[model samples]
Target chain A: MTEPAAPIVILDKSQMAENIGAVARVMANFGLSELRLVSPRDGWPQERAWATASGADWVLDGVRVFGSVAEAVADLQTVFATTARSRETRQPVRTPREAARILYDDRASGLGVGLLFGGERAGLETSDIALTQGIVTIPIDPRHQSLNLAQAVAINAYEWRTLILDAPPPRFREAEPPAPGQLLLGMYEHLEAELDAGGFFHPPEKRPSMVQNLRVMLGRAGFTEQEVATFRGVITALSKGRGRVLAKLAAAKRQD
Target chain B: MTEPAAPIVILDKSQMAENIGAVARVMANFGLSELRLVSPRDGWPQERAWATASGADWVLDGVRVFGSVAEAVADLQTVFATTARSRETRQPVRTPREAARILYDDRASGLGVGLLFGGERAGLETSDIALTQGIVTIPIDPRHQSLNLAQAVAINAYEWRTLILDAPPPRFREAEPPAPGQLLLGMYEHLEAELDAGGFFHPPEKRPSMVQNLRVMLGRAGFTEQEVATFRGVITALSKGRGRVLAKLAAAKRQD
Candidate 1:
């Protein structure tokens, strides 16, 4: 699914309309469409939230307001309380990435997960945190330990989107499975024969392991077909140079 | 070092002091200390930025204000241009996560990196984006595609912080590595014997693979020691019940 519906973002007592608008905007950016407000400071459906949202009306249109954090996350199967501060409670703490993974896995299998973020002032109280099973910490600088309201939401939303999307196709997308292992083996064999003739594999006793080591090292490069061809051409040039050297030495001896 | 400093954030022609202040605050949260302001509309070192920053004065104190983006990122090895709109330029695009991984790896190994973000309006000009080797796209909803300046910075900053931070210890710290494989095998064998005595092998044909399949299925659960113990207890209870039934039948036969 292009959009995941489970991550119900519940902002507890958000201070500013600008912050709420920012949260909605970033949520749309990451494909998160659900917005649940728990007693926002400026009240529900503020015009400033709409105006400041730029063009994210879809998120504003789907707002669900609740009286408390418990009511906001009542139907959620997994709830993560997001805060930058340390809590007195013993709930398991996860970094945003780890929490994203657990939520992504749970949501994929038909469970709704919610992330609870605290307001701008000091973050969720001990009472607020008691509502959820786990905490997601941002690991900010210990000296200045505050994140603006939208900043906190944006971080978690970004992690969730990245994890759920998985590794994407590169924009450059010219890669082709790296020429396969068999072709690489043929290149190894061709190069090994050239090496043996050129006396590059010295001290006959160590020859086998040396060739095997070179093959292994080249395999680690995971070369594309073009690179393999270039290497083969280089080997041909080296062998040709050796032949020319021998001819030059014989002619020089005759001249002497 | 606890903090790696390579990603220098360069803001090009920012219109407002508040947006710049918000960027500084988020950067402090993510451990990035460098800020390069390229020709701000309202000029540099505004008190508005200082007031909005809350406590991220360190970033403002160390800012390198310049006349252009080219001058701002001159000494950096890698520069990523962040834009939501598509550019006609042929630069490869990366999601914030992929770009963050590359920057994190490079910065950790001592290479300087920088991210270029455009102003609040239409984002980077074609001429501005053309200067960079790669593009970082936010992948926003196509229907309504507007992201505020600070929100854009927050998303990329969060990704970089996440990539650089190694897996941290959980807050609750009650996790012991899921019960060892040896203990799991012992539990499997114990349960298997109880099932065998109960004649659950069924038709004597699919016994071995059936038992193995059950073990493999349970292994997927990744049970902790408590789960293993509870399962073993369940098996013991079932076996004991069977023994009681046989004893009752023998006693009734004697009475008859």
Candidate 2:
């Protein structure tokens, strides 16, 4: 049996009753029922929607109306804004299926989960995206990324359904994802040790600038701790044969 | 050995060129080579679309242009119009997999096949639907049937290429689909013989109009010669013992 979650849908200023109904139908198709409409243009219980919904009348009838997306997702601990656009955000962006797995696991521990979708025309506003813990973007051709509201919802819902209904074990669990702060700290320590050993920071005047450049290079590399550790191993191996040779050269240069 | 069908894609007044590029990328994703544009709304080979299409520039470069659906399908004998909506027409409605099977079979016999998708918002119009020999509707949720234009094309193209690329066999012999005129002639002869034997044209004056009405009915059945033969076998079995079943039916109706 598939385990159900506290899956709440948050639609922000959506248009098209037929589409909303279609969303309802899709949600029902995937065994999801909780719909939270945020300021829809077409009011609830639309007749045109009923015809288009085919057999998902329960979803339309059970839809929860909300004044704002935040309010719609107020009860949820983890919320993801569904968008195809890459915006300037500090939060993580997860694929729909990945989000579903996290949400499903969280729900087993009694955590409320919510997914927010933009309106029919333009997707969720910047503020709307900002409200979520993370963003969920569908991997599509970058050129034609304008997915309709219902289509976006369907993709997300399909991911959730695949996770819940499929009832299969996960393929692989990767080691814990590294935190940004942990990666940056490791990079800084690595650069400091390499500079000390190389004597590249000998002239105090050039040391700050050289260190800054090294910092920029290391940052650009986005080195994970494991990668930085690999670089450290390479430095250790080279030092075994060439450390004294380089030090003698540096002393001769200073004498000149 | 899988026989490759002549590449054809029919777009109905597509609003976005980027979406066309996206569709092109998806075509390339499944190794489809030909692209056909039908009355594009944003015109052909938009540069932004090409940039978005990433590695699928070849598809855009080789895109064939057409003025209308009929023009696009001019050379295709077995065309499938993809729509989420079910209309009143009696055309065979199939899933993408089923349509792929038919197209692959047709291709083996040297027949041209086209898969048509309509505009982003409304989908295929009735006239566009009429141009197709059958309909291929994706098995989406009964409540929420929301597949975007490129996504729709991608699903069909994916099914098509998968069928061809995965363990293609040489069992089925493909032949050209029979023309409507040929089908009509086959139906006409079969019904004429059955009705003549059953004494359905009792009054000589009513015989001409009766035969015409029967033609109209069989025509509406969209009968191929094979289907007509099956119908003929059904009527022959029903009327074997009765010398004048039509006359007996008329007398029974008069008594009532």
Candidate 3:
């Protein structure tokens, strides 16, 4: 059997180049080479990042840059965002070890996997997180939640390395690969457009959060490609039925 | 059942204050409070440590300084030293997760436990490692083994916190509490003295390594207080028997 592909490490809006370097060093330490950056505050190719990487040039040398989180994780089939605190999203939260196991299993099944980390200041935006499958929260002491950006990456990378070194027996059932992020994003947008037209989001001010909640709820389904197509078809059928009902009511009113 | 006591963190001969601060932050993040320093290079209470601690003052405030690793862990019943590379000693090497499970069980049994870390420049000395019952290796990629001191502490601390949060069912048989470090040290001294007089260490230059091996071998036994006492009595009886034989041989020579 072929070896599983290592999970891609994505840092979103990271401020410090030094932290990026530290992340790279840890990634190299854990045998993860793929790194993607989303709108780094200092921009890419910072010399300081190389300086702090401690000779982990392979990871930094091949870094990928993206303008947004959506583009950063575009091709990944399963992505988990690291969060410091619990958010209001309906997404399932997992520990680092648990997430690593899932990622290992997903990679073993030939699905691309990634881990998304928010910048040092504000973590991944709720809208950005809605695009992922689940949340990875390090079980830390409540009184002291000051885990820095690199440290967060280190713990995750360490867990991933552990799985690679000594993998546990696959306890989960063999399942269909989750649809790639791009396909899931398409389903989300399709449903959102219909919902918007139907005035399902009552308060204009609540539309953003409502959309996020809906997207998060659906993202947890781990939809396969066929499932995404079927769900979108279901949405299309419901919306067409609504249109037909409205046209009949209008004709009946005209006759009256 | 009462909550298990958190493991103490001992840094042996740490060099940088900032790394010490970083270690403190992670310890607080993982619900470990006790911090012991064995001969920090810059002495205690460096202002930079506080500045880098990111407001984890409680750990810094209660830091205890000792002259040596033996002094720092004198009261603890169980200690595991963290090492980046595997050593040739007979001590069992455990992954961070495994060590955390053992430490949790030991703590639950009312035994004082600690994690010993080496300095940033050089990891724990072999003699200091001999003081520990086992070695805790983080299991990083062998290609890149540049884990910094704080990162090492963070991984171990993270594992410990996981055990506290979602403790698994205790899987081991309930055993007697291990003898404290002081009692074990006494037994080691007694045995080594006898071995020295008996010329068990062949070459004078190899005495240090031989003594370390002996201590490490005996340390794994996790002897209880009663066991230590019994072992010491056995050593005394053997040494006395040797003395009687020597005295009889000398008297026989005089008659001749």
Candidate 4:
């Protein structure tokens, strides 16, 4: 099954056409698909902005224009307003990753998420800031409160990607990073088989702490499934150099 | 009284000279004194940088050169690392105000504060981030994390000024703002005097709640001592004008 649709990005009362393109460029870099422009200045899909967007023309081509922030985010079950300053109103303040995780998790449960950015000169008004459940504050020099809109998006998108895209659930590609869990299981099997073959558990006295130490070392190494399988193969090949019977025994240690 | 010695700003290996000048402009806007360049690309004091800095050449003139972050911050007791990204390291994360408060308080208590900015593309290295005892993260648009270096410095300097200069201080001034404790005490006296004369705390039964409300209102308003004294004078004058009290109070509140 396909993963959830990409979250919608909404820009409210955006004053700079170049910033719009920059935002599109950052979104495209992160593989985001949709852009919602709310009351853009100098009009939407401006040639200057498109030129600045570099290769992110698809964002301009597919942009949906709305009259207001509320209209732009009406379909979103979750919304994040980005600002340089915090407000008196309290909402759950979270780092971008936590927010991204909440959004990613909710997406699977059939909720749409939207991130809202405001005008370059003034930023989101009080009413606009209040509309979202939380604000994303970027840490910058205290002397300058303004940020280019596109840069703001890239940081958040980076955090989200780190949380969500870094670890895809178990699946086989022709050649891909092995899953961590599968790798652990393979390593455990390999260790147990190698130990059995080497009379590692002969007296049964060496079974407990030796196996535990091996497990701990492997855990510390953080080997992936592919790594574990690769290691297991290496172990089997080494055992085969000693004898075929031992190699067969090592092969039998495959977890699945 | 003349303001304290001008503090120094150190930018470590900043990638863009334009950004350096932009940061210089922002620093100049806030009355910061020095711009120290550490391993900048294209070298410092470039003509383009000066052009971008507008009229902030004083920022460039006071510029100091250093090879590394340690050398730059050695004389300073406190240093703050400004980064948009979070690290696995354990540097205490603080808002720019909080960090600035620490620096300003230290300065007030006799210590120097040095601020560090990293390269434009990669940001401050982990070692650099680790060198500082704390971090200041800017809140911004999550999908686009592209703040120019000068913009980042500007925000930090603004926040530092907010903390070190005065609470509710003027935006542009070379003079020092009143100290925090003095300002707080002044506001309290103003509130008490205003409430005492205006019949605001009248009727013994309503005195406690009325006084409590007065304190809460002023507290919520974040009035600096000077602002509170100004309000107190207005209140006392309005009390003298029996018929015009409402109009005077309305006018005063409107201005705020």
Candidate 5:
């Protein structure tokens, strides 16, 4: 039935309401709905969160709050903590992509899975991390290990969406198929006639090889019909531009 | 010796300095150093870019400016255009993961690889996209096809890094290795004793089965030493609170 992804995104002690808004926007971008806030600093229902959410009001409106990280994730069967540094804990750590892979399988099994993101300053404390089975650590500049809060959440959300939905490779169904060989030959002839009239066949002996090369190049491209028409329009523009240049040159000669 | 993994990151007519700075930061995160600015809106050496880059000064310092996309990617052996919408072009379209897989091979063969990121508003013109061999379209929210510019670059860089570096699975060195069965049993004994003293085993007959279930759950978790310690701490806190409540009841009886 293509159920929308419903993994709980638990934000622990998040400091900035604006960043919370950004997170909601990113989560919506990936179709993740469940949001749980644990001990937000400025308290819940911050107007700043709604203001910065842009069009992701649904995520903010449906959020649940909890007093502690343990209670926040009590219902989830699988949980992951995102921390910038490798901590001394039992849980396994995975890159965002790897974590998404595991989350995809766990979600398919109908067991609730959630991701825990720490506050703006220091990330998840060891006690909070101990509750989760795994950690998701994004590879960042070691010298500067922090990413903006929303960027961190955005990467994970993007990974999860990409894996589960399996977006189709791009195709242009609207485009008419490439021009037939015969029709392409006709285009070549027309373009060649125009070029020849414009004295493009200079040093006449080289003209045959040049024309043959041009034909081969066009054939290799397998240009679509619309593209061929566009090229024809370019030729028309060039011809009109040339006519204007010729008239200007004739006027100058007459004045001399 | 490991070569500095270099790929030309080309931003085609990017409008915002903040986006340019962000692109540079993401490129640096993946060890991609080459930056080619193709017709940026505010011209070059933007002070705002340096402010947003955080510590990616190297990318900004080595940036090269070009008048067009063609000029930007001229020296590269392979090029990819990242666009959200499907375009009618001869170029093959690949997911970022797929493109990274191909680029990984091409880069190993010593062929320079490059990516083209379009402007903030409309994406790369089809003519610009046609210059590349492949298109990388992130499967985004169909309704919200466009992504913040820096985000697109970050996802691609992550894929490339994961492929090349073989990021290690996270491990914690000091967690006393998953607690031995004997130690886990000891934790169970300590917690159950505390709970019994607090009358948590209420209606007494059901207590044994509930304890068994708790033991099974903890066993399934493969609790580590640190985690067990944390659970024990929670048990201690609850038991102490119960002792206080009992003392309060005795004190009230004496007052009566």
Candidate 6:
């Protein structure tokens, strides 16, 4: 069997450079080196990051900067966002262990997987979470929900590393690699555009939330590349069929 | 089933008050309250500890200070020391998840359990490690094994809290709680005293290591209270029988 890919660690709008460095250290400790920053609060290449990284300079040196969560995860096939609290989104909430299992299973199938972490203060915005398939909530003491950012990453990375070391026989069935994030994003836009034209999203005030709900529902499907193509084809066929019917009705009314 | 008691967290020779405070925060996050410090480099009640604790005052407020590892865990029935590198000790090294399972199982059987952590610089001494039942090793990338002290606590604490939340049915048979640390310590002293008089520890220089080997072998046995009594009784009988034989030989030689 092919070895699973290491998870890409993505931090969104992280507040402190030390935390980024600390996250890099933990990532390197767990054998994960791909560190992507999505609009860090302090601009990239801070000197303090090197001091805090200890000796894991490779992770820091290979850091990638992105304009948004979408661009950061565009090539990934699966993503899980770490959150401290339960959110109103319909995405399945998983423990770090379960998320790690899914990540490994997905990676074993030759898919790219990443873990998205919110900034220290506000956590991932609902929209950023919508881009991911699931939520990973560390089952912490409800009374003291204050977990340090790097510590959160450490726990998730630890789980992934442990799973790798154990290398348990795959209990899950071999699955086709899910479509990359860009394909999924493209599908979401195509469907949302058709839905907007059809007046499917009522009450324009709720459009953002309605769009989020639609994306979340479809994102969790784990659609394959072919499935994404089929879904887009269906969307186009429906749009074309509706236009044809509208033209026929217009002609019929003119004749009457 | 009775809810499992939260594991006590013990830190040995910790240097920084900030790290201690961070440990407290993670401990609180994982629903572990009892914090014991074994001869912290800086004296207890440093204002900086509170500052770094981030309002986890309840854990810091109830912190217990001890002169040594033995004093700190004297009341616990089972203890696992967290170490970064594998040690020369015979104690079985377990992943944090496995250690957490054993801890929950021991706690479910009415045993008081705890996790011991080492200081920042050197980690737990061999003597300190010999006192525990097993070692909890976080499997990380070997090349970059620089896990921060608080992060280690966080991972272990996270495992424990996850087990508690999952609360799976006990898969193993219910066994008697292991003898508390004090009773085991007493037994060790008794055995060592008898062995010392008998010249069982050869080469004089090997005494420390030999004693450590004996302690580690005995410690991993998970002996119950009754078993400890039986073993101590056996030791006393053997010592008395040897004495009786020596006395008879002296009497015989005197008569000749």
Off by over 4 Å in 6: A1-256, B171-173, B248-256
Winner by lDDT: 6
- Candidate 4 global TM-score: 0.34
Between candidates 4 and 6, the one scoring higher on TM-score is: 6
Could you give candidate 3's per-residue lDDT for residues A1-256 as a string of tens digits?
Answer: 4457789999999999999999999999988999999999989999999999999998999999999988888799889999965545556677999899989887877788999999998988999998988889998998998789989999999999898889665433244566788898898888777776655666789878867766764565566676677556545544553455455545555655
**Interface quality of candidate 4 as DockQ:** 0.01
What lDDT tens digits, residue by residue, belong to model 3 across residues B1-256? 5458789999999999999999999988888899999999999989889988988999999999999998888899889999965556556677999899989987877788999999998888989888888889898999998899999999999999998889776543243567888898999898777776665656799878767765764576566686678556545544543455455545555655
Chain A TM-score of prediction number 1: 0.62
> How do the predictions measure up, each by TM-score?
0.35, 0.37, 0.49, 0.34, 0.38, 0.50
lDDT of 6 at A256: 50
Native contact fraction of candidate 6? 0.00
RMSD of each: 28.5, 33.7, 29.0, 29.0, 36.5, 28.9
Docking class of 1: incorrect
**Cα deviation of A38, candidate 2, in Å:** 68
In model 2, the runs with Cα more than 4 Å from the true position are A1-256, B170-176, B180-256
Worst 10 residues of 4 chain A by lDDT: A170-179
CAPRI-style class, candidate 4 = incorrect
Model 5, span A133-238: residue lDDT tens: 5689899988897688888888989888887677333232342344433345556677777676555656899777555544533343445565566445434443
lDDT of 2 by residue, B73-185 (tens): 76666778898655444345678998888787767666677788998877787655754667898988888778888889889988988887774663343221433343445
What lDDT, from 0 to 1, does candidate 3 have?
Answer: 0.81
Model 1 lDDT per residue over A216-255, tens place:
3344333446556755553454344344445554455565
Per-residue C-alpha lDDT of model 5 across residues B85-173, encoded as one tens digit per residue: 55444455679988887676556555567889999998888656645666898988788776988999998988888877763332223
Model 6, residue B108: distance off in Å is: 2.0
Off by over 4 Å in 3: A1-256, B169-173, B245-256
Clashing pairs in 5: none
Residue B124 in candidate 4, Cα distance off native in Å: 50
